[model samples]
Target: MERWARELTARLPALAPDRYAVARPPAALAHRAGHAWEQLVLPAQAAARGARAILCPANLAPLASRRTVVVLHDVAPLREPGWYSDLYVRWQRAVLPRIAARARLVVTPSAFSRDEVVELLGVPADRVAVVPGGVDERFTPAAAAGPARAALGLTERPYVLTVASRTARKNLGVLDLAARRLAARGVDLVAAGGDRPQFRTEADTAGILTLGHVDDALLPGLYAGAAAFVLPSLYEGFGLTALEALAAGVPVVAGARGALPEVCGDAAQLVDPTDPEAVAAALERALDDPAPWRAAGPSQAAPLTWDATARAMDALLAEIVA
Candidate 1:
């Protein structure tokens, strides 16, 4: 959403004169609202400005919006009940379909997710559009690794990198085993996330390096510099990081699960995330011949720009308003 917001503003500065605006409603109001974005202040602002349609980037939307377009990223919580919080699971089960039913058009990241929405919510297939994500301009093969590695104190070695939020469903255990196997083969692993301190501690960091909360700007460099980038996630609506790594000209190793394969295409070495040995083997393959796999990366993430997204959204809104 941050990328979307930034790109949209850059393309259409009129919509956002100051380029960015950070509005903080009162703490009391936030406390009362349950969800901060759906609170009285934001909804009132939307309504008062004659905003005909509301766009909820995520599956969940403010119930108060009369006309809405929602992007349902995935239906994973519904499929894997034990993977999320009780409240989150319940809310997803109950509220997501309601939002889809109410939304004029539902957008999803991949055809896999679109199929789930169509089957689960019974929304028409035509109503859901697939908009694959793109690599940011900051991501490129030329991105400076020296600054990023120096800042993170990374010692140069054949390193496999994985970037994730460390949720249970991400299958961090697979990565733990893969790291151990890689270490035995004279390779190191580096991981980065905002909420993965427990994973860092538990991964037995003897040969692994955990750069907790790496600077966001350095992410592109990190991806470009790695020997290989791997994602052991069990499920993903769309693996944006894998696509980003591929776009940066880095060979990818990802599980043949969910939308990872769809986004990666022939650009990645696919494996079962549940099998640690498979992940390790895939990582080794990518490391052995990273150059041959570079061409398989996305030809070009065309028409995935945020301006394209917002323009499509604007057209949809115009129809509803008219």
Candidate 2:
């Protein structure tokens, strides 16, 4: 969310400097209350700036404002309430409807999420706009793969890579089972993201190496280095990491679920995320013949740009203000 805010705001000056301004809560207030700060302080700050409509890039918006544009990534809490804490679910249930009801326009990262919002949150379809996220130009096939492989202690062995926060919704269990099957074929599984103690312990039994929180600089190289990049997530708002892998000219193997198929298009080998055998077979196919996917990936990711997203948002804002 911070990245989206920074990039979109940075591009706004070139798009229409006089029309838009970035509004943020005070540092002290932000540190003290976090989301509470956004709810309590941001709306007034935006109003004081002579803003006609406030654009809240992050999901939650101040309930007090009717002329606000809120970007809702997904209605995941409502769809899969089991994945979140009780308090978190309660908070989202309370605030999301209010934001959806009041906001002048609601922006989402994908059509899948827009539908989810309309169906799950009872928001009108016309009020929701799909504005997918973009992959950074830095994620290119030109990045040296060797350094990243060595940094992650992967040596020269070929590995299937998946980048995700360790969570049940990410469907790491399927990856774990797939890894066990792939081990016999001499292919290792490398997972890059934060560690969840529960999921981390399970990876060892399958011989999957977990690199907790890869540095931003190394991520492009990591994507470039993989034999194939996989995302077996059960649900995703936009599947940005799959887009990143496509941008890196890597062969992708992802689940057909959520926004992954839309993001990956024909560039990836789509599989049933719930079935380990299907994921394993897809990984094997990708690793065996990566040429076709590698050639197709960059083109798939080329049209997704932050500039385009910003322009779309700029036009939406203009319409809202007008």
Considering every candidate listed, which one attains the maximal lDDT?
A: 2
Alpha-carbon shift of residue 245 in model 2 (angstroms): 0.5
| Per-residue lDDT over 22-56 for candidate 1, one digit per residue giving the tens place of the 0 to 100 score | 23346565322636556345567777766666666
lDDT of all predictions:
0.72, 0.85
- lDDT for model 2: 0.85
Count of steric clashes across candidates, in order? 0, 0
TM-score of 2: 0.93
Which ten residues in a row are the worst by lDDT in model 2?
A: 196-205
Candidate 1: clashing pairs of residues: none
Model 1 lDDT-worst window of ten = 196-205
